[model samples]
Target chain A: MMTRRIIYLDNAATTFPKPEGVIRAVEECMRYRGGNPGRSSHSVSVAAAQTVYSARAAIASMCGAEPERVAFTLNATYALNLAIKGLVRPYSHVVISNIEHNSVLRPVSSLSSMKTDYSLFDVVGKAQGDTEGVLASLKSALRGNTGAVVVCHRSNTLPVEAPLEAIGELCRKKGLTFIVDASQSFGCVETDIEKCGISALCAPFHKGLYGPQGGGFAAFGKSVSDREIRTIMQGGSGSASSEVSMPGYLPERLEAGTVPTPAIAGALAGAEFVKRQGASRIDRYERELVEYMKKRLSRFDKVKVYFPERSCGGILLFNAEGFSGEELAAALDKRGICVRSGLHCSPLSHRVNNTLSCGAVRASVSAFNSYSDVDAFADSLSAVLSLR
Target chain B: MKKCYVSMSTMTLAQKARNILALNKIKANVVKLTVDQSYGGCSWGVETDCDDQEKIRRILDISDIPGYRFIRGKE
Candidate 1:
């Protein structure tokens, strides 16, 4: 740990300074409940299993899904890979969004090698909360062999949120499975699987949930059967050891190998914390911070903020003149400010925003962040830009 | 005071079955089934009072929690 005070604004990558309860839960889990869940009948093992179940139940409740339908993974990337690869049928086409993170884009790209084609619909040029443009683009991209549609619920680099309910409706109308990468929206945004008719909703607990990294999940809706998804990874699920094939169930079928107990415990506490704080409340506060940052950023003549007219969530993207994103980020880091630079693992988003050349610096906020933090960031950014 | 074993495919299903029974005012414990008790290899079962066997069966059947089989006469 550095002795200097640091202002962390990279909540999109992973939340910093986790909630007290989350830290306590993780420590307690490792100290007292270190048993492998679902593998034994001992008290310790049973307790561990209960902890896992509670985490799953918490996620399921948030997503309007059954507890059994929630399968925990290392992170959202694993969950997205599982959802995209398992749900999309062979020789079928899929439709994705133009502003998707590499998690969704890469899997869909690799699927092309398996003879699965995909189309990219433009999520740009649409105002916040508007889904008509997205729906029209999606409809035009659907093909005769289209089996699924995967889209990011919220762009990681910008404040853009895709109209999930609208996309879900379109997928339902066409009898297509809707796979959503909710990495940026989960925990902070309201996501209802059954109500939205989402076939699969994948999210990470570390982002808006205030959980530690290494824990995420994919919650399947009632519309898609477990059998519809083919298993990508297979191992002992601690349930059916006799059969060579994986168990025929929602979670066990997908969750192979032992899950990270400490991470799950921390995530459970984080989810509970989010629930107590109220997701809408957290969202509103973060958006307020973003708005403040945008206002302050406008004072600088050299700063160029993207999508200034649209309603952004917690993230704000901008670049200072006469400096690449990397240069700006490095200068900010020297001043004890943390912000992500470059494409943010989202070339597709950069491409859509026309910022792929030098990318943009992204500053995201979480509930732990305060207005003072925003002030410090703006002051630091201004001082850095003035030097150039 | 004897118990009946409701065999489940996975521990998750067993836990779900136990919760469903608990909501119906019935107490059940998730237990690991031995090789002799399990159908194929390792598995889990919900151990509940034998007197509520029929009630538990009906409750699980109507609920979404699916059980492999109900093994009775196991104290």
Candidate 2:
């Protein structure tokens, strides 16, 4: 008899087995519309430009933004770099959360030396003690020079949800730019840019969006003045070729050089698939599955589960007694269970949770996960914990 | 089978809701009655009249908690 294949639960890193439509879209783009977008006057080039614009429109609709305000980037990291480095000026103040991914943390940390004062607030416990606490913390951290407030919708480890609407209201009141990093929570959670008052939002296509690895996009809010947010890169934007400078527009101004048309096309398919399925239904299903897993894990005396009161998505972080996180992860891997065990790029969160040394085992679920998969994981975990 | 009602104050925010649902298994709906409003937390009411009372009681016993008031709904 043949053994079963490994069960994938590390979706927080990247989604696998691209949805059929996503693959088909990429293949179609490569085969037929292989011209440079916004480059030439030829029909193929125009078709390519139309495909890219359609993708931009889909992403914008999903995030509740206008099509023209959306611009594609290499990935969330690059988009974040462009947002932070381009927006904050010398002596400007910025507000951030302690649960941000390295994409936001590292970039902001690097900018610390430019005489820009930054206040990193802990969202664990502030006024209401739930995600609402994070919003209050962000509001309190704002100062007179507060040029922008950057926040991660969900944490890599804790999975604590951020109150984007409340924070957005405060930023609007203060006339400050509000940037959101939706890397882990974009597709799984609903984001209404208009309601949240978000000035800019950076998201990767690979994770919750279920797109190819290389493509990502940023949605710029209408309230954000063009002069307030500068472009980090300058070069070919498919237009304005006569002059060497970048175009004085929204997307083209930031999207310099050749666009990843194939990746964007694939992401468009993924976004469409997600839209068809409905993000709210997906969210509810994942929440129920996570609750089931949490219940099962709680039965064992040795298992230590870490879940926030309010979750952003389906990522679960935990460890068992008498066994290191790495040891358990390796043991599970031997049993054909895929999980991630490490700092997860947010060192500050690990240090705060005291899981920096061995780190915590992360089992993130996706829309593809089934009830049987959760059962298998729970049984495998029980067996692994009993080994010691 | 007699109904088993679990109080909200007895279990942790997540545990209280989950335990009642698992025990009832079928034909039961967990209701949030009154709860500690801190951190958006609240209480729930579970309907367990459709299942076996002894089985439900055993399951609830294993799922230990504090400050709970169990009630039997009219059968």
Candidate 3:
């Protein structure tokens, strides 16, 4: 029996049908270049280390940072945890946005036990593309003891984009460290760490870069010294082995144990793919598809589109009149249509959008998705909702 | 020609140093130090035939490569 094709619309969780180059890179790394990086001096090990270095350089170049400043992790959550738990002072406070994922929310919430308090600032005027409201709300939320400002660059469930430049400027003016969670925005948006004055920009490769899971990074800016950010996990960094503590540098300071070489090699290819295709070109195309999806789905009377004006063109959220988001998703799933439903591991966003009760259905697009894919998804969703 | 080893903290740094030196008309090989030469269990360095400490130091300083030490010995 031939396997039915899946219509994957869950790019926010992780992009599917990765680029051919990315898949080939991973296979080649595992087949021919399988060696322990940064651990030995053998030719095989040296070659592996070189491949990893190339990946680091790619990630750094994309973020406008030095190669040594990028530290690899399992995913964006670990990277965000490193940035938040590492930078926030014990007695100081932090300011975060209202639509943060649990990655940011849980870490900040956990920090409260250590007397590290946090406050939330709404991304005001996000729908209108106005930064002044966000700046004003952020200023109002600031306290004298606020040492860091963490914001999600894009909401995973909605298209809410926090004003990075405005928030970065405010943080700089207030003498605060700015940490950005770019989990949902990295490859889909253009970002320059130096220009934006971001202290640490954390993101994963699986979601937008079209790489396999198990690889992510936190790229630190020049303003952040090695000693300023502490290490949450410590192990053999393949550097300064004699020292009892972790190395006093970037990359090695935060990166402990063995990094996933195959995953990183694939991520490097993914980054290269994005570079070749042009991030702006990809963004424009995906936005067009999202606009088409929004218009097509809204033609049905029972479909109530949520945040129609707030989306930054990557993700769309909606619900049918009488069907819960989960039920609609289940019905669609039976038809081989893949979409995420419920809270989307982002209760904070649900609460803000008044979707905390039944949750919202999220259909995220990627550079690979086309108008046909969107049409199929709409037809399947319509069929699912009509059953009510 | 005398060969000398420039010890670096990590393999990434050693590789970076090799690339930097190559661009400046210098040839260097990344090598692993033996147990006796290894500072902390295992260490990495770049081996270069040009042993002029002053010239190498100047080049490294200009490139801003950090935390490297020169140890003179035969591999």
List, in the given order, the native-contact fraction of each candidate. Answer: 0.78, 0.00, 0.57
Report the C-alpha lDDT of model 1 over A1-388, residue by residue, as the tens digit: 6598899999989989899999999999999999999999999999999999889888889989999999999999999999999899889999998988999989998987889989999776457766788788888999999999998888998778888888898889999989999988888888999888899999987988888889889999998888888999999889778889988887999999999999999999999999999999998999999999999999999999998886667999998889998999999999999999999999999998899988999999999999999999999998998896
* Tens digits of lDDT, candidate 2, A299-342: 88998887535455788899889988889889999888888988
DockQ measured for candidate 1: 0.81
Worst 10 residues of 2 chain B by lDDT: B8-17
lDDT of each: 0.89, 0.76, 0.87
The TM-score obtained for chain B by all candidates, in the order given, is 0.90, 0.47, 0.86
Query: Candidate 2 clashing pairs?
Result: B31-B45, B32-B44, B35-B43
Show where candidate 1 strays beyond 4 Å: none
- Per DockQ, the best of the predicted structures is 1
Could you tell me the interface RMSD of model 2?
A: 26.2
Could you tell me which residue pairs clash in candidate 3?
none
Top-lDDT candidate index: 1
The better-scoring model by lDDT among 1 and 2 is 1
**DockQ: the better of candidates 2 and 3:** 3
Show where candidate 3 strays beyond 4 Å. Answer: B35-41, B51-55
lDDT of 2 at A243: 52
Interface DockQ of each model: 0.81, 0.01, 0.60
Could you give the candidate ranking by DockQ, starting with the highest?
A: 1, 3, 2
Candidate 1 local distance difference test against the native: 0.89
